[model samples]
Target: MRNQLPSSLHNGMMNYLSDLEWKQVLDSLQQGLCCCGANKYADWLHTPWIHVDFLRENSHTVLRYMRVDGRALPPVLPSSCCNPFSPTPCLHDPLQQQRSLSVWRDTPQTAIDTVFDKGCLDLILQPMVELLTAIPIVNGCCIALQLISGILLRYIYTSARNSVLVGDPGGKAYGWIFGRGDCRFALGSSLLDIDKKRAAKQKPSGNSGQESKEIGPRRHE
Candidate 1:
């Protein structure tokens, strides 16, 4: 807080804390009406200006306290945002989709072991899903065929986007109108899993020394 004064003030934001101010406020809150939550120890991770030593010391104690006191903390989650709540681009080709995310799920000792687990949801999935809901209305040719046509058109769009239709001229790539060029790296199922696996390997593990040789574009290992 002390070191961050200039940027916060220049940005037209009031500083949220100072040492003496926080100490006083914390004293008051200990006696206040608001309940913090079940994971009171983990909750401090949300606070600013927490000390390293305190976190190192009291953090474990707090988690233990919460556990013993029967307090429950929210579980951390990985989100792709598209689910059965969405059944578009994803459910399009079930077999291909798993090759990206669940690559390892099917690995056998004889098979090249491969599995992908993309962590964060990619930016591409949402817009593609929305495009799915829009097509039936966009063509609007006939009331009877509209619903069925929209679903089929959505399938065509996804196939064009993922596999590159390859027949266009005038210097446009296949599926150029579908915007795969813009969002190609933005993420899709199998590719996202590859990204996730790479990211996980980059984290510093107990074997920090060996970590140097461990990450970057991977291959069958």
Candidate 2:
């Protein structure tokens, strides 16, 4: 089926909805509409025509939760119930069975009143609104990071190209370093040469004086 989104939402707004937001929406939808005191399997099977009408009226929203393929969902059933009066002893669809199992497994002794409260649209909207509010911040950060990355990459490429062309007047040293060795080695070698010169300059003048004194004593002898 061709998935339809609201035209009111812009492409930029959609980017703010992460997988987490979609999951939350799905979870809220699965909660289903409030049974409104309809507890028994038979009660659910014989749900008021008005309630069904209400569901039909809001099918755009309700169908998303009920049916995967936009077809009518299988009837809800009790966990361990049988109707001997009916022709089919166990009229359970695999999908309905799985749903019933999950409901029972989660809350074995769920209260009748709490079993159904309200539709999940209210719950679903809470997260949606929060996500919408954060769009500006999230979008701004993403744009800023992209801009910074582009600028950094351009600067690096320009610097590398310039170093190979102009840094070494002969170009041979830069060409060798850029082609055969990495820029890191080129930069490290320069730092290493500076350190070697500093170490040579730091050699003790006292040591040279000591050598001269020993030579003078030997000459006097």
- CA lDDT of each candidate? 0.34, 0.40
Ten residues in sequence with the least summed lDDT for candidate 2: 1-10
**Per-prediction RMSD in angstroms?**
35.8, 15.7
Candidate 2, which segments miss by more than 4 Å at Cα? 1-115, 165-221
TM-score of each: 0.15, 0.28
Each model's total of backbone clashes: 6, 0
Q: Mind giving the per-residue lDDT tens digits that candidate 2 earns over 1-221?
A: 01222221112122222445533443333334322212233333333212233245363534534544343333443222333333432433223345444444465333222233332334435577788899999999999999888877766664556455444433322212232124434334453354356567878776788888877745434
Model 1: lDDT to the true structure: 0.34
RMSD of 2: 15.7
Residue-wise C-alpha lDDT for candidate 1, range 4-80, written one tens digit per residue: 53233222111123355534443233223121211232222222232232333345433432333344221211121
Winning model by TM-score: 2
Residue 114 in candidate 1, Cα distance off native in Å: 45
